[model samples]
Target: MTEMENKAVGYTVQQGVATITMQSAPVNALSRAVRVGLIDGIESALSDDSVSAIVITSSLALFSGGADISEFSGGDLSPNLPEVLDKIENATKPVVAVLPGPAFGGGLEVALACHHRITFAGNQVGLPEVNLGILPGAGGTQRLPRLADPATALTMIVTGKPTSVVKLPGVFDKISDKPEHLLEDTKQYLASLNAENCIKRTSDITLTMSEEVQGVFDAVTAQTKKAARGFFAPLKCIEAVKGAYTLAFEDGLKHEGKLFMECMNTPQARAQQHFFFAERAAGHVSDFDKSTPERSIEKVAVIGAGTMGGGIAMNFANAGIPVTMLELKQEALDKGLALIRKNYENSAKKGKLTQEQVETRMALLSGTTTYDDLADVDLVIEAVFEKMEVKKTVFTTLDKVCKPGAILASNTSTLDVNEIAACTSRPQDVIGLHFFSPANVMKLLEVVKAEDTSADVIKTCMKLAKRIKKVAVLVGVCFGFVGNRMIEPYGREANRLLLEGASPEQVDRVLTQFGMPMGPFTMGDMAGLDIGYYVRQSRQAFISHDPTYGAVADRLVEKDRNGLKTGRGAYLYEAGSRVPIPDPEVLEIAKQEAARLGVTQRDDISDEEILVRCLYTLINEGACILEEGIAAKSSDIDVIYVYGYGFPVYRGGPMQYADEVGLGEIVDKLSTYAERLGDYGKMWLQPSDLLIKLAQERSSFAKFKN
Candidate 1:
């Protein structure tokens, strides 16, 4: 046997077979080194007299996750992915690809380029380039449709989601009978192939547009438009796929490359890609790493049995871990359990879960009515009321009942985590796992680090976040942590805009056009107007200084208009519908609130002014957050806002959007607003010092070394 080694991949000949193994550990990112090695390895195998067949597989690593995204930040390198893939597809000898795990995006493109592809039952493959706001540049959109059903291929490309090897029939030449025997299956598959049959290329396959396929294209295009709405990449992906059917293979490849470049240069692409890295970066803690040991949280307990608590308990059950739901009474416990069952059954009805799978997950959850039931739990998170005293009582009980080293978490969105930690004897074990409402679904989890929280606790919770499929953004303890704190100024401005001049519909229209899922007024109405009224009462200073704050919302609730529940709030809802219709009555109420609060109502508020005030105030608060070190890095704040607050994903959260809008522009706009509003603007809307510095220097939060 002869061996040839490179930095990222190796070439070796054993018997009549040449094996090219990728050496990048973990997810073998298709970096420049790997591309060079792949081209070199294939050429070496072709030249060697002893080598009759070739197999490309990773060396003790999961299959490639696609392009090395970090490399994207730099200039072009030699032998790009397309060049490497073309070398593989055009190889002389029979080439086989053995996928060990997921082959996503460009990685799947590489496998598609091989003459014969083989994988295990559980292995997945996809061209998910649409996620990064780009279509597949290296022939993925072109070649995938050549082998698979065009609609299926188009669906996979448009959605940017991985599919099981078995689910995609024509794509893989051979599949392992057992999930663990992919290598054996590939060897047998290679043994069956000779040069006469093994040298087939995806480019030679012809694709034709049929009536059904055209229908699929139309349906998917419409669906993508509706679902992704303002997104730029998904529609581009469909266009690239359509090229595969209309144009020749080489032409399709060229078109795909053009589309890829077009999407890559888009601001939406930059924003989505920034969020991709930001979400991953949020998991890393600067002070502690692998050396900081994490405690096990196998068994969990969630106190309270309401919507938040029940949803919190479901996350553990879904992960196949035992969870105890402890309410003060049996009735509450049973009601919570029923809601959890209903949620799972609904998923089962939707085919998202099998009946057996639903039962299996439900079996992992149990309900109890005593604090003593939580003693044996590894972690206990209180999902009770948001008041400080109520959280203290829960922590005090948890401290007395929970085992030593057990984590005590509070699901308090606006209260101090440190004060709750102070009520416990084990302050080091206390942290905040603040799951957003409908906890089983929302991705953002603010891991609030209290004053006395230990590194181990942080590490454990961070690790646990991965298990539960949540993006854990570590934040210092403060009022409302990151998401709520930032939203305060944003919501404040939107509401104040209502009283000053802008109608509810006008403010909402401006924000939605700026790419928020919904404006603050719509969100407040859906969340219930009374909720804001009570929150305003709690923060007397938060509202007292600014008389216009919460005035419309307070008056709406006083009229028994509590939003969707009451059929009226900021906007009136027709019976049995959630579509908020702009009511003249609501505008009249706003005018009255403005008069009562002694705020001057002006008709000159432009849509641009509304957009700037709402988003810029949010950005200003984000800057203050960065300056205070409450958020570890600026990107973390971006991730929290995008995932937690429905701040536009394509705009890359508040800070990234600000950087794109020009920091200097923001400083000028904010300064102008402060001067225009006098004392109120100076007190509330002044640009943070960090924003002034970054803007003057023409720097971006995305360019930060952290």
Candidate 2:
């Protein structure tokens, strides 16, 4: 027996079989070193007469995360993934790939290249390159369809979601029932394969072209166009798969490579990849050390049993943490509990949760009308109204009732966490867990770090957010923290655009076309215009200087047009329908409001101007947030917008979008808009000094420090 080793890979030969082990810890990324080692190990196995069969497996927990995305941004390295995989496929002896766990992206591509594949039944595999704005570049698109039916192959590649290897027919030659016996299973399967049972290369499998197959391609093309709007990779993924039916094996591989590069070269891909790293980066606390401790949260309590409070409690319940939902009255408690049950029941209906699972989560949630019931709770989150005084009152009571060392959290979106912490005796234990609307559904949780909040509490909440499955972003205490602070200017500009002559639909169309899930006005109407109307009222001192800041919205709310609740808002909703229909009365209201404010309502507004005015201002405010240290990094802001607000994922977050549009270009546009609108634009859309400095230095937000 002989053994060989490399930095990220290992090779050993025994019993006439050679094994290649990927040992890169924390998801074996197919990096340059790994690639080099694979080529070396395979070449040695092929030349050695002692070895008849080669097996590729990982020494790590999983097969691999994917291709090293960090490598994608840099220059090409020797022995790229395609060349390595090709070497494995062209080997004279049978090469078997074993997966103990999941294989995604290039990892699955590597396995597909092997002559035979074996995995545990529980293991999953996918070609999720489309998620990073690229199709499978390493012969995946061509090979997957050759092995699996084209429809199954198309769905897996296009959606970029993992599937069980057993579900993908012909992809895995053997599926082991139990994971503990993976080694034994692999050995048995290898022994069973005779010369007659030797499998052909995946690329050698022919896919017959037919009208029905073409229909599957056409239907997926239409579906991908609708589902993956403004995205470059999904459609390219479909095109690459289509080549499998039209082109031969070698030609299809070349076609796949062409489409992969085309998608990789797009700004959309750059943005998606940036977000992929940014979301992971959002969890790290820059100043925290390895020694930083995190507290355990066992029992939980939530104040207020309304929609927000109920949703907040559901998160803990879903995480298997017992929660006591406290309300001022029993009736409110019963109502909140019922609503929570209804939510669980609805999810059970969708098969997202089983009937037993729904009951289990519901049983974890208990309701009470007394603060005394929260005395033993490990953490208490105040999910009451947005008003500061209301939050203060809740915290003051929590400071008295909760056990010492218990973490107290506020579910406030925009109010100051610092001031809320001041209400409690143990300010260090008080942090803001600002969950978005429909808290159970929304992925973003702004972990607001107050000035007096201790590091342990911050770390503790961040870890807890992960337990509940959230994209937690640590942000400093401020008026609106990270997400909402930047959105103020966004909503302000969108409103001001109405006065300057852009209709509701026109502004919405421009923004939605630019990749936002919805424009500000439509979002405002859906969230209830009265909510913003009240938020404005509470912050009147902040916006008192500008009379026309939200005059149109204020007037609408004053006219009893709260939103869909009243079947009227910026646009009147037809009875029982949430669709926004243009109302002449709303336009008349805009005209009157504009005239009253002494502002001109000109129709010269173009879609480009509207896009710049709304997005660029939002970007400028993000720069301000970065400078203030409200957000530790630009990526944190992007994480908030992408997850909390429906800022388009393809566009990345606002900061990533700005970098793609060019920071210098953004600065220039802000200046131009300031000159065009004079005082109004200068007041609202002024670029921050940090933004100016980065632009002048020809730098991007991604590269900017401080």
Considering summed lDDT, which 10 consecutive residues are worst modelled in model 2?
193-202
- Candidate 1 residues lying further than 4 Å off, grouped into runs, are 210-212, 703-706
Q: What is the Cα-based TM-score of model 1?
A: 0.96
lDDT tens string, model 1, 1-706? 8887796898889989999998787678888889999998999999999899889988654678899999888966778999998999888888888887788888899999998888778777888788888988899998899899877898899999889889887998888877578766766777787656878888998878889889999999889989998789999999999999999988898998899999999999999998998898898778578889989888999999899999999999999989999988898889899999999999999999999999999999998988998888999889998788788888888899889999999899989988889888889999999999889999989999998999999999999999998899999988888999988988888888888878999999888888888988899989998887888899997668777777887888989989999998888899999999998887788898888878899999988788778889888888888878899888999999888988888888888888778889999998999889888788887988888888878897666442
Best by TM-score: 2
Error of 2 at 41 (Å): 2.0
Question: Where is model 2 more than 4 Å wrong at Cα?
Answer: none
Give each model's whole-structure lDDT. 0.87, 0.89
- Model 1, residue 438: distance off in Å is 0.6
Separately for all candidates shown, the number of backbone clashes (residues 3 or more apart, or on different chains) is: 0, 0
C-alpha RMSD between model 1 and the true structure: 1.8
